[model samples]
Target: MEEFKDQAMEQKAQNTETEQEMEANFSDMEAQMGCKEFHPGDVVKGIVVKVSSDEVLVDIGYKSEGIIPAFELAFTKVDPFALLKVGDEVRAEVIKEDREGNIVLSRKNALFEEKIDLLEKAFENGETVTATVIDVVKGGLLVDVGMRGFVPASHIERGFVKDLNDYLKKTLDFKIIELNRGARKVILSRKALLEAEYQGQKESFWSSIQEGEVRKGTVKRLTDFGAFVDIGGCDGLLHVSEMGWGKVAKPSDVVAINDVIDVYVLKVDREKEKVSLSLKQLGPNPWEIADKKYIVGEIYPGMVMRTAAFGAFIQLEPGLEGLAHISQLAKFRVNKVEDILKAGQEIPVKVLEIDMEKKRISLSVKDAVDLQKPESEAEPASEEPVKEIAAAVEETKEIQAEDETETTQTTEFVSGNEE
Candidate 1:
């Protein structure tokens, strides 16, 4: 009985030892199988393990493998095989796991985080990066790098940006001006970057430019007297008179906003950094050909074009007009000039005098008519009329005397025949 009892005790002890060992093995398997605590939106590093036709498997230090979609692995410049191979390390984001399964991950979110990180570095270094303007709102715009960034409307351009839609999808190189994570504020400036670059380029361009260099420019802004042009980076004025060799009634007539044109450098002021440009220099001077075309004492057929307080203007050619001055309109005295002449009247005029330096011509209308000579030389005509009347009276007296003589002879002959 003692030997049997001893054997039972030894078996029970062996069973206990086996149970303990099994429990230890189960605990170790559970620890190895459990995934790490990875929250959604957390960026993490991973390694590519299996590249399949459908998907690429990544081990992100998690118990289960992470699958990246084939479409998500697309890269244009470098071959996908070159950018990603088996055992390649990469960064990714922790998207929530399949609730039914283990944790899931994304490469796009990781790329976004990387972009933001790069942007932060650029901000610290005062560097610029190109971004697309996604939306326009009141007072500002939404620019997109990886995440959306705010660009105040005031900072959209060198001055004011009227049409915000014009910037949409247009990538602009910009700099980060302000950023805050807690308040969720990010401000960007394209003009600030532009201004700095413009200053440098303008200084270099203006240094090499002189007062007589002709260049091509675009009309940026217009005013009553002139238009402003962006020559290189600085703005220069193209005055109304400089716009054309002919008369420009207003600056808008010759130049329109955003019109690309060529202009001559009229004057350069280095101290003020101001340049004066002329558009007329791009063409021949109309006045240079005026003297050769028109001469004094010559007649020109013209039409009344404009009525002024001083006179009616007559246009002989397209931009050249002569003033048929108030004093030269009629032969007789006139109370009002308009009473004798009206606008749009076709009239023959003779150029009495021309002043090329003053850009004026004196014209006359009355001098173009024909007039009769004076009657002071008619003394012989009066004498001839009186002598003809005296001759007629003398001939009448001779006729009467001859008729009386013939009647008396007839009576004497009749008396002799009767005896």
Candidate 2:
């Protein structure tokens, strides 16, 4: 009976041990719960899930999406459609949770909180930043920084810009002159940045520049007296009289805005920061070589450029002209200069005079015509041989004079109308 009982207990124990050898893995089965709760003054990164005209929906690892009101999208007037798009990553501040458990957020406030720190440092360090001109407003342009920044009309460029509309939709660099974080106001100036950069460049340019150096420049502005050319960082006056070898009636006649041109550096004043430039000096002066090209008592072909009452201007070459007096136009008398010589008429002229100091030349048409005549038409060698021979005898007789004999002397021109 005891053995039977032992066998039964052992069998029961064996049965209990063999009954179950089962184990289930619970490592992956442990599920995580509870999302992080956001409160006011919290900044979080979120992805834009939906962009709308009035609001934007962003997923910021919350139970519900964050709602950003249109006004909260930017400090300035903004079109959310243009500013934000679907699936854009955004950094925002949690303003509050509404009664319905919806999260209200502000992108503008978050950007303000972050960029203000940077802008303050930038202002203190005199650093620069790039900004986009959003719209033209009263007295100036509105730019998109972290918040709205004001740039006055006078701060748009180095020079005055008449039309403010030109700055719209343009990106420009600016320097922060005034930053009032308490008042939430920021005043910027592009001119300040330009002036600073130009000062450095101007100094460098002046160091390397010397008189008589030829340089390339762009025509920047035009005035009645001259055009202003931008060489590097400085503007030089290019007067109308120095624009060309010929005549330049107006500055615009010689240069246009944005034209790249070569110019001679006439003078420079580093202390005053003034530069004088000349365009005509790049070429040789036409009057300098006049002696080599023109000679007295010679004939040259010329065109009657223009006629005046006193004389007719005959152009022997480009920019070289001589005056032909009305008396020299023809052998006989002329009542009107134009009747004898017309403008644009080509004729041969004798060079009678050349004044190097005054740059004047005298030409004669009659002399030139006479030179073209046949040798057969030439006059006798001596028109009055007896007069010449008597003059020689008198000169040699000289006061054989008063002592030898008294002689009566008479002079004549030896012409048919002699007097």
Candidate with top lDDT is 2
- Per-residue lDDT tens digits for candidate 1, residues 1-419, read 99999999999999999999999998777678754577888877778988776567888756788766665552211245645789899777777878666656666567766676787798899988888877778888887676668998888888877788888778788889987655545689988987898889887977787888898899999999899998886689999988775568899888899999888999988888899999878777766777776678766666677777677787666567788776676565434555545566555567787788998877876564322222234222233322432343244335435655776888789988998
- TM, every model: 0.64, 0.68
- How does model 2 fare in lDDT? 0.81
Clashing pairs for predicted structure model 2, backbone only: none
lDDT of each: 0.73, 0.81
CA lDDT, candidate 2, residue 210? 82
Q: What is the Å distance of residue 13 in model 1 from its true position?
A: 13
TM-score of 2: 0.68
